[model samples]
Structure formats: structure tokens, C-alpha cells
Target: MISKYPQLFEFIEALLPDNFSQSQVGMSGATTNPRLVAQAVLESPHQWSDYLTSLSGRLTEAERARRLYDQVIVEGARQLHPLWISSRRTLGWLSAQIEGGEDMDERALVARGLQLARLAPNVMIKVPGSEQGYRAIEQLVAKGCSINNTFCFSVSQAAACLKAIHDGRLRAQLQGVSTERARYVISFMIGRLGAQEEFARQASQRRLCLTAADRRWAEILVYQAIQALLRRRPTPARLLLCSLKIDTDVQGREHCWHLQRTGADCTLYTLTPQIIEFLIRSQQQGRPVVPANGWVQVPKRVLNRLMAIPYFNQAYFEGDLAPADFASQPAFITASNDAREGTQRLSAFVQQTGDGAARPVIPPASDAPMEHWS
Candidate 1:
């Protein structure tokens, strides 16, 4: 029986699945944190047993957890190495976050970022989009290290990251080093905005009614605005669409289709396995999957309405939305709380099972201006 449906897997692979090959398309990469690692360990304990055994007598509780994290990142990088090479150093980069507590210092972040970048050729260090994070990103990029600026929720954050990348590339150029190999990605989290809109609706009993569709529109606008900005002054940095919330509804599917249509160059989507599965199921069920021909035009009225929201304005306008601004917004506050709690839980688990190997010491920053760490 010839299936009338499009080959769902192929369609998604063309859209850049996290770990799949599609020569015509730039293969997207994966980003991992403690939560993802913990889930993986639970799903396949036997698979990770060897990793644990290797650390059993050699490391402390925290040190063991850190080693396990690095192992996972290195393995992932190996898997994506071909994509990295095939893209001529453009794609196929895996991101590993600095595992220190949230209050980790800037100097420590720079040291840690340098250490992570050395783990594998395709590894890009994931740094938080905080003030200290931006500073660290500037230092690393100036030295020719690729970076994934994570936890970005605003245009201000994204713009700041791009500026850092530009400045760093210039520094590398001046030092007689080719920056063709440096890659920078600014991750904009989408689903969290929808969640925030939904919560506001419920809290006001629909009086402050903003549907998920509205939030999705807002996200697209933000992305379009950022792309437009990038076009004016091209940089090595690319925008990564991430933290997508899976919505199986008609509107949700339409939003996804629209994004696929944008055909924005240098952009990548990092989707979770569950979301990929959802897309496959949706396509198999014969749901219409229309490809967008061009960027969706958000109506002026809608843009005005979105801009009326202080958070939306700050995010879109890149005005005064400092890293600390996250605490003042409910959506960001919730995300921060969730991350802190998750890290604490993961820490407790590590403490219980980890052997006491000494923590890995990050070497001090090198004196060379643009020397690649590796």
C-alpha cells in the first residue's frame, strides 16, 4: 500500500533532526544539561553502568557527576563529528554546560568554558546568558572558541551575544588567526512564552486572555525581528530556535509549519525526542502539513498589542532587559526556580551514588590573545 502521507521521518530529517543525516540540510545539534543526563541514566541504567564503574574509585560525589556529564557530551560529540566536518565546520556541534552552581563566577566560567571546548573538536561550550555569562562568552569567542549562549529569553540578550561574537571574531582576525571555524548560536526559548501567556489567562479568568496562538505569533515576530537585524550586519552567529513546547493542536501545527517555511539561512531548530515523535505521529495521521512559502506577516494590530506588554517590549526592543530582569517576570522566575530545583535534585542524586574523586581543576586562562584552546 502506497502511503498517501509524506515520509514524516524524511520531512523532519530535512528540517534538521538533532541526530540525523540530511546532506542537503545543515544537521542541527543537541544541547544537554543535568536533567537530560539524569533522564537518560534512568532510561538505560545498564548502558551507563560502565561509565559509573569507571568513576567508582576515582572521583568524589560531585567529581563523579561531572565526569559522567563529560562522558555523555564527548559521546554525543563523536556521533555528530561527521556532520561537523561535512558542514565545513558550520554545524554538528554539541553543547555542554558549565556544571557549577548558578552563582558561579565569571573567571570560573571562562576557565570552565575553555576546558569544555577542549573535550572534543565538535564541542561548543554552553554558557548561561547572564551578565557574567556574556563576559565569559566575549573572552572565549575572542580566543576563537565557539559558544552556545543558552537561557536567552529576550532580544537584548540575543543582541548582546551577537555583538560579543562580532567583537571576538575581530580580535581573532587581528591576531592573524582565521575565524572561519568559530561558530556562535543564540538560543531563543519559545514554549516558555506560551506557558506564560496561558498562565496569565488563567490567573485573570480569561480577562487578560492571550491564547497560545497569540504567544506563538509573538515568538515568530521576535525571531523575524532578530533575523532582520542580523541581515543588516551579518555575523558568524546564528539564531537557534529552541525550548519548543509541543502543541498538537491545529494552531500549534500551523505554527510549526510556518516556521519550517521561513527558510531562514543559518538557523537551526533543536527539538526534543518527544517533540520529534509528536511531529511524526501528526504527519502520519494525515494532518495537513503546509510548508510556508515565506515569513508570516504578523498584523500591525497584533504587533502593537504584543508590544504593550512590558516584558514583550523589553524582549523585542532590547531595552533594559538585563539578566537580572528575569527575576521580575513571572515566566522567567518560574523557569529559574525550576532549573535551580532540578540542579539541586541532580546534585543530591550524585552525592548519594558518586565516589569521592577530586573535582577536575580548570586550568587558568592562557596569555595568548587568539590561540585556540585545543
Candidate 2:
């Protein structure tokens, strides 16, 4: 809207709280260049016959051109924060880049990324846990590079990342250098498979079939992976949950709350704005929004089930995707048709847990009022 009607920005600015955001927008003028680059890439695949025709020159020249194009993308992502911060964009960009890679060539990509690192400290290089990307991650981090580990679903991916961090930390130690924050963030994409009804139904049935394999998912695997990494050599690496399928199991007479009520720790959860709005509205309506008793536990039954699945091998996931790409699975569409709608009250929770096998008890609806969980 601001791009179409510049005057509207003035009004919008006035309405916004006096913040640093407004100041930045004023300082750096906005343009549609990034969109054009995106369009160019999209068009290049099948739409731009002329460009393809024009580029069919010597092999040496073509390689240089490809490197230049990849640099543009890396730098563009570097400059634009939050705009392309979503896993979808980051994942898509990384996917497309790799799909276009020839003969497993990562030499040029690494060089370009290294150049961009010198450009800005806030910019983060995004890579996957693949052998190629892993190598790039280590080299970059060694040179004080920050990176996001995209497309990680299994523990092996986490293990590889942990090694990369340890290796970087070792290199830094040798060089007498230090990093302030986590040089790498392992992205644990959830909801991809759990989102779809058919898949969920099939998977639920499948879960019963392969419950053992399912136990090795994000929370448990990541928790264990973190411990494994910390044991070798500690490096700041956080597990970020993304593409959550259950924006909220804010359903049935019983709202399914999976997150533990434990105080904030290393774990991170990412939700769409839609979910945030829904949560806000729910609180307004006096729904009981309670956090879980503890972080979701990977049950022994689930661990056993995971072992049954033919393709659920933990080692296979350490490399590129086998048959299923975990990053793309948020199988089901979100449940809440209207994030804001006539809704039932939230599931009840007890202020205290009961003794022995007794479950925790929720306070009476009348006893408590509205408030943020944490």
C-alpha cells in the first residue's frame, strides 16, 4: 500500500507508535527490486526462452553468470530481514539454488556467501544439512559467519549441524576468536506432516503402524541432539520449530496443548500471525489458555513405532531427503477457518498437579481471569 500511495505512509506513520521501525523506513526508501529479482528467477526456469537462448554461449562464461546470479540472491536475502525470514522463502530459495546446482558444485556459492558476510553482521547465510551445505556452513562459521540450518527434520541432521558448530568452535579456538550468538540455528519443521487431515488420519493409522519411528521427532530428538552436541563441545545452536500445522489444537471441548508450561529455555516456536491473533481474541473472550504440564515427551510407544517404518531410518535423514521431504509436510491446512470466530472456551487446566497417578487439576473457570501464559 505504501508503494502504491506514498502519502499513505505518512498517515500510517502517524498512527504507529513512535518506534525505530518508522525511523528506518524513512531512512531506507523502499522499492520493488527484490520482487523483480524474484520474478526474473521464476521466469528464467521456463518463461524466459530468450534469456536461455542468449546464455547458451561458452561453458566458462555460463558458469560465471550462474555464480553472479546466485550472489544476487544471497546478497538480497542478506539485506532484507524479516521479509524473507519465513521458512517458506528461505527453504524455497535454498531448494531452488541447490536444484540448479551442477555436478554438486558449491565452490562459487561459498565464495559469494563469504563476500556477503563482510557486507553486514546482521545478515545470516541459510544452508541445509546436506554434505555440500554442511561444508559451506563450517567454512563460513570458521570465518565468523552466521547461518540458519534449513530442511532439518531428523536427529542426524541435528548431529551434523552440531559437528559443524563444534568444528567451527574448534577453529575459532585455534584462531583465538569468539562468537557472541549461535552461529547456527537448526530448523525443526513441525506440522508439515501433521497438518493434513488425510495424512493425519493415514499417519495416525501409520503412527500406530510405526510408532517407534515417530518418537525420534523434533522435541525429543532435538533435546537429545542438544545434549549430544553439548557433550562434545558446546556451541550456541538453538532448535527452532517452524511451519506448525496445528496453529493450535484449539479444538474439541478439549484444547490440545502440547507445549510445556516450563519457563522459557532454549527451544523456540514459530507461529503464523493468524495464530497470534486467534490467541489474542481467545484471551479477550475469557477462554482458559493454559500451557502444557511439560515439554512434549517422546513416548516409548512412539519410539517403538518409528522403528517399524521402512523409510524411517535415523541415518537416512542425516543426508538429503530420502522419499519424504520433512520440510514440506505441514500436511494439513490449518483448522481454525476464522482465526477470529464464534469459539468455544479454551480447555481447562489445574493450577496444581494431584498426588500419585492423579492428573493435574485446573482451577475453576470463575477462579481465574485473563492473562498471558508466560
Candidate 3:
């Protein structure tokens, strides 16, 4: 059947696995985390078991899990490799994160980043948006490695990511490296903001009544501001919108409509398989949704109200918000908690795979020297 919403399929085609050749959407990249990996294993045990069995006799439990994780990610990169080639190295990459560590130092982050980047040419090292992550982003970018700065909950964090990318590009230029092949993405977790808002409302016993769409708009405005800041850069990195939750048809329609209205360049929307299916169904049943000819305009009143809030200002304007500040934010706190739990689950999975394995092997530290950008 022909797609009613070709643009939506175009976007999906850009991000899906290589075998999905229905459309030629130019998705810049896709990302996978520990939770996502675990989910895939659970949902497709037969497919994953063969891969897991191959590594059973050769590695420790943790090592086996890590390798499987990398294997899956590399496969994804392979699927998206065509886009990378077609974009002239500007897009079509997959991201793999450094597992098991919550607070890695800059050096450690870089070491892990380099290790993950080595898995595939199209694999982007996914880093958390901690201060150390920012430093690692700069270092990796300088070395001409693609980086995806993940867990960015606030606008300040997003700005920090952009600054790091800019600095790294400059350093790459100095080191005689061609940055035309380098790409970076700052991801904003969309659905989590509404969850956070709800959490905050319940804990404080204050009813700051706002719909999920309202909360999402506030988050989008922050992204829009970041996009404005990036316009100043000679070669700006892409913005990725992730963690979209579609609970109802209306919500799904709204999400699709908003994406259609957003006319930003090099922007990517990463959807779960369920959401992608939902969009496909929506398009088949509903009328065609066309891409907006212009950028979606945020109401000045809404923007002003969001800017006036202290937390919002601190997050979007200061670019120096502390980790503690993020702890108080519902969305960030929830994500952190979820990540820890996900790690524990992976560890359990590793343990279940018995002790009949080879000796533990530690991945080598990256010896790449840090280049300074003046």
C-alpha cells in the first residue's frame, strides 16, 4: 500500500535497519542504550541467542554481554552505512554507549568512547551529558570521531554539548584532520519531560496543571532556542528528538504533526518500533500530513512564561547548572534511576549465563593525545 504520509515514512526510512528499504529517508543517525538492548534480546530471544552462543566460550559474562551489545550496535551501523556514504559522511550513523559506569572521568570516558567508536566506522560514541561527558565529546570530536551527547535534559546541557562539538571541530582543523567527516548530535528526551512535570506536581502537592502537550512544547522551545544558538556556528551539529511515548491516537497525531511543522535542518526523530507502526497506521487511516513550509512558531507568551521560571532560565540560559540541580528535576532523576536499574538487569542477564567461560579481558585504553583548541 502506498503511504499516505510519505514524509513520515521518509523520516523512518532514515532511521530503520538496513533491510527496511521501502523509502530513502535521510535520517542522520540512530541510537541504542542498555535498556533498548535488553528489550531487543527479550523480544527476539531466538535471533539474539545465536549471537550470544557464539561468544559463550570465549568471554566472561560481563564481557559477553558487552560484546553482544557492541555486535548489535555494529549491525545497526552497518544497516545505516549507506546513508552515511550517501550523505558524504554527514549522516546515517548508529550510537553505542559506554556501559556500567555512571560517573566516568573525562579520561575514562574518552577511553570507552574510542573503544566503542572502533566497532564500526558509522558508529557514533554515545556519551552521557555529564560534565565529564562534555569534555570527552570535545576530545573525541577533535580526533574526528562522531559523538552523540545523550541524556541532555536541559537547554544548558544542550548548549554545553554544542560548545564541545565546536571546540573539537576547531581542534581537528589544527591537527590537519578533515572535519567534513565528523558529525555530532545532541539528543533531547521528549516524553520524559511530561513524566517529570507530573512527578513534580505530585511531590510538591501543587497543581501546576499542564497537559502533556504543554510540557512537550516547553521542551521543544528549549530545543528551538538551542537551534537558534547553533545557527551561529560555521558547521553546527544535528539535534535528535528521542523518547517519544505515544499512549493515544491524539497524542500520536500531535507528535507526528509537530514533527511535520518543525522545519529544522539535520534534525532527527528516533521512534520506537511501536511508535513507527502507530504512525504508519495513522497515516493509512487519516489524511495526509504535509511538512510545514516554515518553522513552527512558539507563542511569545508561552516562551516568555517558560523563560521567566528560575529552573528554566538556569537550564536554558546559564549553561552552568550543576548535577545536583538535575537531580531535583523529575525527568532527569527518573532517567538516572532507570539507567541504574537497566544496568542491574543486564548484570543479572550476564550472571545467568553460567561461569563456563574464558578469562576476563579488559579493553585497551585509548592512547590518543588530547588536542588543545585555542
List all candidate RMSDs to the true structure.
7.9, 17.2, 7.7
* Model 3 misplaced stretches (Cα beyond 4 Å): 1-18, 21-23, 26-29, 46-50, 56-58, 197-207, 247-261, 264-266, 304-308, 318-329, 355-374
Q: Candidate 1, overall lDDT?
A: 0.64
The alpha-carbon lDDT assigned to residue 194 of candidate 3 equals: 50
lDDT of 3 by residue, 109-148 (tens): 8988888889888887888887777888899999889887
Please estimate how well model 2 matches the true structure, expressed as its whole-model Cα lDDT. 0.42
- Model 2 lDDT per residue over 1-374, tens place: 33533544554343222441223331121111122233333333332223333443454533533433444445444544432333222221121123221123357547756654544444456564455666667776777776766555556667777787779777977887666543456655443333334433444665453232242252344444444454565567766655433233335332222233221345544434333334444444567444444455556666555445433444223443332333232221121211111011111100010111212233233221111101
Once model 3 is optimally superposed onto the true structure by TM-score, how far is the C-alpha of residue 38 displaced, in angstroms?
1.4
Displacement of residue 158 (Cα, Å) in model 3 is 1.8
Q: After superposition, how far is residue 148 of candidate 3 from its true place, in Å?
A: 0.9
Of 1 and 3, which scores higher on TM-score? 1
